[model samples]
Target: MVDQSAPLPSVCDLAIWEPVLRLTPEDGTERGAGRSARVAGRISPSGYSIAHRGSMPSTARIAVQDIQRELARGGVREVVFRAEVRPDGLTTLGLVWPSPAVEPAYGSVNLGVLVLADGSLPAPWLRRPDPVPGAVPAPSADPELLERTLRERLPDAVGATEEEIAAAEARLGVTLSDELRVLYRVAGGDWADDVETAIRVDKAVGCEIFGVEHLFGIDAASRFPGWDLGATDAIRTPPDAVVQGLAGSPGWIGFGTNGGDVFAVDLTPGPRGHFGQIVLLGHTESLGAEPVADSLTDFVLGRLREERPDRRGAELPAVAGVGTGRLASVQAAAHPALEVLSLDGGDGPPFHLAPVAGLPRLRTLTAMPGALADPLEVAGLTALEFLALGVQEWRVLLDAGAVPRTLKAAAVTVRHQDHLPVVPVANEILALWDRPRIAQTLLEGDLGPAAAPA
Candidate 1:
């Protein structure tokens, strides 16, 4: 409807950006008068796709898909756009090319540097378990009964020996919790030749309990959202929280899965948690695990509830947002232990970054285009390893020679304007770190005039 099969990255290629433009306010809708959008998706000979959030008017939806189709004709395979328009007109139409530069977190609109050019992960991945001194198991923990219950349920189940369990502890450097050790001793997690995984679940255990040899501890990097969505992630454990909200812990012995999600025994408990509680790691979530049962005994007894008492999070979040309907500003989100600060792009004046410039543990910062009052202010974030900001903001930083030298990776956010000019700015960023610069083929064409407003 807006534009079809336009040439890829062609010079003066107005048609290439027209489809996206139609979705903006130039059509004269009051709602589109001034707005910004973040989009990510793939395009190919098959057709075009877009990762737009929420429902859209049918006309806009068709235009959204058309944008990919139009860009595909130009040889663009994948696209991530940070586009904005105003009552006056679009000042900057920004497009981030070779989306692979940003970590591929499929089905999610990931912002910022996910993986460094050196093939290293962000700070969150390097997190290790904190020392939980004198931690002990809960009163409900019953190694003898846990093993006996499984023995009764799976009478034919083949179990592991104590020597083998001891061997696992030696190999992993983490002692298995009492209940967990017994659960493996009873079933050893492996199924027999005659019993299918599903059949074994119904016959004895409600979940597929893993074997002694299969256990992996806190360093288990199992989730698939990749580094971008996870690099800035943090968890909070409230005073009454049963599980210590953590990115990862050496004491969390991952034993098995609930058919899909991984299950672990949390030896490093929260102040309110028991020593050996059963916690679940979501298959898709890239962050923290939640408490599922007081002990493995409860998991086997079917006495489990999925809800967490402090499900919303700690009174103060390790990851904070500055926006409307949320924390009012950076000062509100600032804390000594703050790890991430994301400035939301609502229709407002730019936010000042001075409030959080001195947070010691702060490592990641992402702001929507036009979201920051001064990009140079980011130079003060010495601990920053990842930074994402608008191209204009980056120019001010680059020109002033103020780009934070501590960044391991960076992303250039953009808003409505020609993309060709943005490529130089992105390359400048990569050049700063001596990282690989983006290579894009440019083609030029004009799609004529804008259509009359409905």
Candidate 2:
């Protein structure tokens, strides 16, 4: 007999116990050889009570089925039994095994079950409480430093007041992003200093910030040819009305220019469109626009600190009667790394180009509507590989036998007034070489067969 009052050991402290049903005849027959004794006991949380007749089966499966049937009658959904061998050669039964559905107990505090020495079972253990989740914080934006930087750089800069900016937003029918609004309030659309004039025109052509006048007003649409501001219903005729209208409705708001090139704010948002971004459009029609800066403030700050080419050291020898002396001086000072030179005689009087020594890297030369009396002046440039000139100068060089031997390619352009067929001239140049690489440009009409294969 076991003591029932001695404070039962915690469920975790107790060893697993298996209950066995032994049979004995009423007439004092040997225990396992005769009729079996009926077993009656609860299966803890399963509330099962076993009651069997006759002799207990030697097979483990028969015994397990007996236990399962008893568990099912007590409303238990599942039952797992383990058989333990006793000294009498009979197997004892153990209740519920550890599984995913059964949560582990916390030491002695909530061990899932208690088995008595006599195989009587107690109540099941309680479960642990679930944990609470944590809260996530929001992101923060930059402070007033960005706006302060813009003010410090452009001291004479004029910024749009809150009312003016709001009015513009109302008129444009689009909400300006926080970054853009901050930019307008710090520095509106203009620089008081000679910012445009200070930019190097020759080095950075077709890329300059616009003045206040070009930035504001309903007539601003006129500054950008082929651009239709239909969103604002502001359209104006371009100076050269012959050019076709630009493709696609204007998706950007124009703010600056590099000569004829445009810089604008991209308003469309998507994978391809960088909304609230600034972009630079190249002067060449073939080149597509490119993103320059993330915002207007960044673009302006970059321009203010941009470095111009150093032109103070160089000097060109004065050549009397040749009107190119000043032009040569300016060109030398402006482009120190120039390898290709393009000149237009229409910009000034006809001038003789003196052989500019020390230009060891000069290779390609293009002259438009110019009277180059002696093409031999450039014969000394051993590196010269390509030459482009007006039809008159090309003919002059062909007659004088002064075309440089180093020349591998040559292009000719025919003016509208010359009324010369481009093919004939192109063929003449091609005839000069057994395998000539030639290109021709027609100022007005098309260059039929003479057009170079792309």
**Candidate maximizing lDDT:** 1
lDDT of 2 by residue, 1-454 (tens): 1222211122211122222333212211333333222222223343333333454445523544555554455544433222222233343332333322122222111111111111111100011111112211112212265476655655555667887777766765545556556666655554456555335321222245443234421122232321011111111112322111222124445556767767666554223233555655456432123556655545544532133222111222211112243354323422324345555555565544454434554555656556454565656555555566676776777778777666544555433223233334545665665432222221111111111113
**What is the TM-score of candidate 2?**
0.26
In order, the Cα lDDT scores of the candidates are 0.66, 0.39
Q: Per-candidate RMSD vs. true structure?
A: 5.8, 42.1
Number of colliding residue pairs in each model: 14, 8
For model 1, residues 113-158, the per-residue Cα lDDT tens digits are 4234665556656666566786777777788878788887878766
Worst 10 residues of 1 by lDDT: 1-10
Model 1's TM-score against the true structure: 0.76
